[model samples]
Target chain A: MNSTFANVVARRDLLRELTLADLRSQSQVSRLGWLWWVVDPLVMMLIYWVVVAGIFGRGERYAPYPVFILCAMLPWKHFTSSLNAASGVLRASESLIKSIAFPTMALPITQVLARFWHHLFGLLVLFATSWIAGLPLGLALVQLPLLLVFQLVLVLGLSLLVACFGALIRDLKGFLGHVMRVGFYLSPTLYGIDLVREQSANLGGWMADWLPRLFLLNPFAVLIGGYRDVFFFNRMVEPEMWALLTVQSFGALWLGYRVYLHFDRRVIKFL
Target chain B: MSDAPKIAREKNAPVIEARGLGIWFNLQSRRRVSIKSILLGSGLRSDQKVLWALRDVNFEVADGSVLGVIGPNGAGKSTLCLALSGILTPDEGDVAVRGKVSTLLSLGAGFNRDLSGRDNILVNGAYLGMRRDEIQSRMEEIVAFSELGDFIDQPVRFYSSGMRARLSFSIASSLEPEILILDEVLSVGDQAFQRKSRERMQQMMARSRAIVLVSHAMPFLRELCTHCLWLERGHVRGFGEAQEMLDAYEAELAPE
Candidate 1:
């Protein structure tokens, strides 16, 4: 038990170092450097805003659609970017994995942490935009950190699951690209849960009763809704929903870690 | 030199022990076997050949001794090193290791090419189990040992192969781990640096650290090693005192 605790501490130190290395290399390689972190989400927001608000003339329900979309978009980018980087991480770090005796799980965790750094910058942009758009700051904002932590837990779990299979499957990276593209529309990034409920009610049957619940089960649906409530709608996420999300996020993490360990030895051989 | 072997073997406690160790590799799937191949049943082809890279190997390393592994190319010396260092999991038997291990498997194996030498040192040091504060404290010593000077701050991609060898060796050595594993790492750099490294290794040995070295340089092995392990075609050909093993190895080479 003592050695195990020491092992955990050592792994944590290695994770910190690798994440810093990843972030440093990323910033140093590009000409614009750290500016890209802020710019990336803003650019993504502009494109989505133009399409949903400008071209389609949808988003009439959510005024100041930019802030509404930015809140969820930032977290969504964090999710997708982390998974994308993790999907090929084992194969990409072949030399390091082969040479060092450290835990392999650090590879995927580093991706999540590095991307989270960028996500933090996206949050800064969100706060500035909220201030400029004259959105009210209230006690609802107190729940922001809790929401972000839960989202991080969710992303870490998914990243580990992807990294484990992605190392062996080779096709997971491309497959995940498609899945995330579709998932983006399915989540409440561009619209609100109100839109989903109203659309579901139009169906007017058991489909109406089940479709919204099914949507909420996606985990991101709950998280994005929470962000919207805190940042745009000025309300707390429903207690039952927050409780469910807490369970779901940690459950995914537990399952992901189990799956990763199951394939951990095989992964190095495959690589 | 006469009493060196006896002095090296004076310590009786084994720091490393392996029994019936084996590592198997799928010859047909040297690269990653794709999921598409498995789905299509091509991965199930009976033509796949399994290669036991190391089979039924047993060895032990006592504290304060150097065990030199010598073999021809593809004789599984490096495989044994990997297993010992805990990088590769054994397929059949198990290896037991005590105390901290630091491995220099290959030059620049974990160094990020885009990062500066100083940054790579911190990163590699962490991989070798050093904490950030520990690495920071030893920063000056590692840099000075590498002799990278102004080049330490430049991106490692700009470094010459010799410079990388110097930096990696310096960092690994600075860790001063309980067990040090090296795989042909001392072959690079200029002759002066090689001699300096050899002297540094002697200093480490004098301090009673265990070492696992793989090299083709017979004279260096004979001079530094107390025990020698000879691997031939994934099996142990010889294991005993360093002098006896080297003599037998040289005899075999002369006939060929």
Candidate 2:
């Protein structure tokens, strides 16, 4: 038990080094350096806003849709990029995996943490945009930290699950790209929860009552809703919803870790 | 020279023990099998060929002993080193290692081409389970041993193959792990550096509880190894005293 604890501490240190190296390599390779972190999402926000708001005039219900979309877009980018990296991480570190005996899970965990550094930069941009848009920067904003933590737990869990399968299935990386694209549309990024609620009411049947509820089942839907609530609307997601999302996030983490443990040793052989 | 407590070193107590160890690899799935092929039912149509890289091999290395593994190319010597180092899981049987193991499996195995030689040392040291402060403290010694001098700060992508090998050897040897596993790494760098590395490896051998080395250098193996294991086609062809095994290996290589 004592040695296992020591091993965990050593693994944490290794994770820290790998993550720092990943972050450093990422910033060093590009001419723009870390600016790309903020700029990438900002550009993505513009493209998404132009398509969903400017062309279709769909997001007017949540006026100043750039800020609205950026809130969710920033977190969504974190999710997508982390998962994408996790899918190919084992293959990318093939030589290292073959040579060293460190915990294999560290590869995906390092990717997720390194991407979180970029997400923090995106959050700064989100705060700046929200402040300029005259969104409330009040007591409600304190909830942002908790929301970020929950999203991180949620992302880490999903990344582990994806990484385990990704090690075995060479096509998973490409397949994940398509899945994330479809997922972007499914989540309420361009639109608001209110729009979904109103549209459901317009259906005027059991469909109206159950449609929005069904959408909330997606952890991202609940998470993005929480982000919009804190940053843009200056409100709180319902406590019950917060509780449910928290449980779901941890559930994903537990399930991911379980699956990773089941396949981690076998995964190394494949790599 | 050993850093481990004196009480821990019981003379001739085995630090590494392998019992009927076997490692097998699927020939067809050695390269990653894509989900597309599996879903198309093509994967099911093929009969998998399992190649036993090591089969029913057993050995034990006691404290303060060096074990040299010698075999021709494709003979699974490197596979045994990997299994003992705890990198590759055994497909059959078991290997029990009682101490921390450090391996020089391949030159520059974990290096990031964009990072400098010095940065790679820190990264590689961490991968070997060294703490940040520990690596920092040993940074100068490791760099000096590599003898890369001014090139230490240059990105590894520009490094020559010999320079990368020297850098990796320096990092792996400097850690002073309880059990050291070396695979064809002693032939690195220029002749002068090779001699220097050999002397450094000798010092490590003195300090480490056990050392497992894979090499084609017969004279060097004869000088260093207390025991030798000769593998042929993933089977133990011979195992005994260094002189006897080396004589047998050389006699087999010479014409009748």
Candidate 3:
């Protein structure tokens, strides 16, 4: 990995300019402007709580199911929404990319950052809900600051590949969303991880063991499970599992960044 | 802080260099993208027919000089400028530039239409490789030079096309670029802005850096350029001192 790559990309300020510009334009569109970033997502969470909470024997599973789902869904929402925003970034910025010298992955990087700003608001709401529900808090939750770093690297690295592909093939936008949706259900979010192990001696058990451990490459799962361990149980994230997760997250990151850099120089000419 | 020592730049090396420079459109060999296919959403492939905007062209511009490029409608002038700016990669051959470049390919080629004039100024400042502090220091000068009135606060799309041109040109020329590229963009404004454009070019040229002026106006080329290259249908027919090339090119343009 090039040590200076990220810093150089950040210095270009194209991403910064575009982000500030996006924020400014967004603010002018409505009087309630920037606040909509938070209010919109919280409203979606509320709707899901009202609709889905009542349907499944969702209450039987655990404490304050609404907040639990929100905690799990918060980072997931960011991951998915970022994919949607990033996929079209290159195609839309034909002017900037074609005419200037800068990192192409800055497109996906901006998408991740803008959505991260939105996700941070959702996280605050999660903390508030946890407090209202009277859930226990401990040092386990502090892992968030560290874990989110890995999540960001993973997201930035992986989404860049998809953004490039999306530029070439327009349908990649819908394809990525559909794929993430499937990953949502397949993941242990909202549901327990044991479902797969329950069918041990078969493919289900095999998947359960590998999915959470190996696929910790997915920072969201580690984040969600870490949330459950910290708030729901007041326990520390298993040290061994954390190690596995860290390696996978950064490993995916290293490879993805290479792919992004490999194609960056060609983007201007192609566009 | 380090006091920089002055060093002489090499003499033999050209300030601008292009060798056998050729750029061609992909001409994706497919019968798609025609209006019939586009309306029906059926033709997803590209057409295959090579269109050479520039071919086997060769030129060298020395340090502290002015080079004018003149050609007819399809003479690859803008393509050459784009290559110089590193915006387009040549399919064959190479281009190397010694110093920073600020290209005025068109009035609004790089500006965001939806942004306000002030916002576009900041955007252009950063696009021209100015640091934040650098742009902030000069922000007022840019605004005043634009003479945009209260319209500067409104989205650029709300302004007349001429207003957008003024903002882009002012912000771009406000910075002293080592290599300046002017792409026939001066004809937009009224006579007053044209005079200002010429004045700005003269001031920039006075700094003793190389520049490439591409225009169809042979008289202006003759008047301003220290050297000139006359292009005819993607070929360079004359390249030498400005007056001589212009004389040769004009003779060719005469009825025959």
Deviation from native of the Cα of residue B36 in model 1, angstroms: 2.5
Q: What TM-score does each of the candidates earn?
A: 0.92, 0.92, 0.85
Error at A152, model 2, angstroms = 1.3
Task: Name the better of 2 and 3 by DockQ.
Answer: 2
Q: Residue B84 in candidate 2 has what lDDT?
A: 80
| Shift of residue B81 alpha carbon in model 1, Å | 0.5
After superposing candidate 1, which stretches have Cα over 4 Å from the reference?
A1-6, B1-12, B38-48
lDDT of each: 0.84, 0.84, 0.71
**DockQ of the two-chain complex in candidate 3:** 0.28
Candidates 2 and 3: which is better by TM-score? 2
Q: Compared with the true structure, what per-residue lDDT tens digits does model 3 show for residues A93-181?
A: 77665555444565677778878777787878778877888887777788778767767776776777677666655466766777898
Tell me how far the alpha carbon of residue A2 in candidate 1 is from the true structure, in angstroms, after superposition.
15
Worst 10 residues of 1 chain A by lDDT: A1-10
Error of 1 at A61 (Å): 1.5
Q: Give per-residue lDDT, candidate 2, residue A110.
A: 89
- Candidate 3 lands at a TM-score of 0.85
